[model samples]
Target: MEHRQSFWENLVVVAIALVLIQTFLDDFAVVAGWAWAPREVLLYAGLALDVFFSVEFLTRLYFSFIRRRTGIYFWHERGWIDLLASLPLVLLSSGPAALALWSGSTIALGRASLLNVLKVVKAIRIARVLRLLRLLKVFARIRNTDSTMAQRHVAKVATLSVTVLIATVMLLGIAFSVFDVPSLETAYQSRITTLLAAVEGDLDRGAPIDAGELAARESSLLAVQREGRTLFSRFDSDYYARQVGPNDYGFAERGDFRLFFDLRPVNRDQSRNNLIYFAIIVVTIGALLFAYSPHFALTVTDPLHVMTRGITEANYSLEVKVPRLYRDDEVFELARAYNEHYLPMKDRRSAASADGFDLSMDDVQGLLDD
Candidate 1:
């Protein structure tokens, strides 16, 4: 039973590692500006992992109750964090599946707003990045089995890594919200109005008969042109041109003007994507460091667990040997030395008892008298 539990725990570790790798790939998709096809692959891969984790969580929960360890399961087992991390992905992944089903219905096919719904589904899918926090909890659990010294060292390093990651994310989020959002929104709005006027041919209105009218018209046209150029410069020239359909004005600028007016959301999405990339790199490195550093500690502590168990059992006249570890480290050497001294002493005592050689002063006096 214990072996089976260990097997599952090891499998869970591997699953978590794969999930983190998928997350990193998703982050790369954002950073490298991957199109929908590649991004969707990563998204589906993440959703599969989320399903696996959800099942693992349920299995553990059921076992916790069956074993009558609800308190330890809830608090010490970190069941809450597991649920938080898995539920979001499950909910987000279901959106697209639900949309696919709805798309085949007559009412859905008739709706012009389905494209907007699809966009919302994509946005929700991106939010699965929040599940990366579960990796930190996994790291904590892995190192918790180490000796006190090892635990202290691992705790310090893990804390530092988490702190740096959180600080980086917070700083980027605050800077983007405070500075970039307002400026980008203002620029976007100004550019939209200019584009709309240009597309309507309002800027081509004839100069007035009066000199003041001619001057004002010329200045206004120049201002509108400048703003148009500024907005155009925000995008790659070729890409902007390609996105501008016959009826559309430029990148993100439509003839209808309704969709073009609300550019703030687009800017916010881009800013969010940037932060997600930053978080992926930062958290991946931290998790890698925290996850692998405990091997050295585990080596020593695993042997110690065996040695302590052997010693405890030896007290009840049961001979026990500390299982020899395969490593040639200090702990291995100590185990060797302990066995070498202990086994010989144990053998001598057993031999003496079998031969009735009791070292008593009364027996020695009787022998001397004889």
Candidate 2:
């Protein structure tokens, strides 16, 4: 049967096109450093796509069962692709980052292991890129072409996409970490300086130093030590200037007494910055993958699909029409050759068969070669 497009199918294609547009806009907002509110709205729109696709998959399964082709659809017809792409990717990607933000947890010494586990969880957002495979299935349906060929091409493209994405994310992750070091160090120094001046001012006024009162006044101070002994400590064990790194310690000395502050608020700020950076990466890469996937169909798979289908269905003549937009391409050239040469030769052989003409073996070979 000749390929034909239906109105409802065309409507679905339009919807997919709009979804791709939304994905691009979301990425643009992230790259442009727009406010979070609009970016978030764009992100929630993805949930609707997830729900839409889930329903579409269910509908496909229903038809596959009616046609007794469930196995064929599940494997050969790319039903697995549909199932994977239909997942609630927006929620899956956002949930970990949201938890990181809401928990207000830090990668301080005691919590480092827990934060590492959460970072691993945040990596699940990378799977969101798999949603782009739906573009291949849409092209297959729109063009009435074989899904397997498009699936093969899409797999190759997807591998390249994932490689580039992972590399980009790793480089950015490293960049954020390195750049954060200086800012964190400066913040710690400023906080320490301010607290030291406050304590010294109190001492100059002939006030007795009270470690407990100082710690209560300073939120960043987890503990305060004096004269090589614990004066006041928030945790069970005393955290001294020597026990932790220089960035997590500040000290003051006055003649015979030495005072130490257990400084770790800078570490908390670093963890929050890392979470924000991770969220930005996920949004940008997901948008880019969705925006570019359709171009693969237009330039590569769609034309190949039309040419291969035309050739396969050429029993008497070429019935599938080559898309006019591909006129300058090799696929169009193949279609032209099939129409101008192969069909005429086929017609001649058919006439010979009807007329009882005993053609030579060479003539039969020539006809087959055409």
**Best prediction by TM-score:** 1
Superposed by TM-score, candidate 2 places the C-alpha of residue 200 at a distance from the truth, in angstroms, of: 22
Candidate 2: stretches off by over 4 Å: 1-8, 88-91, 94-114, 117-121, 141-370
Q: Each candidate: RMSD to true structure? A: 12.7, 14.0
Per-residue accuracy of model 2 over 1-370 as CA lDDT, tens digit each: 1233366566567767766556456445544544446655655576666667777788889989999999999987678777766754544643433443347442232112422332333344334444554554444443322455544555445444544554565555545444544555455555655666677787688778788877777666665656577777766643332234333344455533455555444434443443454344445444434454455555566655655654444343443355678666776576667667766776676677653334557878977888
The 10 consecutive residues of candidate 2 with the worst lDDT sum are: 106-115
Using Cα atoms with residue i matched to residue i, what is each candidate's TM-score against the true structure?
Answer: 0.46, 0.40
lDDT winner: 2
RMSD of 1: 12.7
Candidate 1 lDDT by residue in tens digits, 87-200: 666776533433443463211201234334423433453444446556665566554444765665655565456545644654654454445455443354455445444444
Residue 241's lDDT within candidate 1 is 41
Candidate 2 CA-lDDT value? 0.54
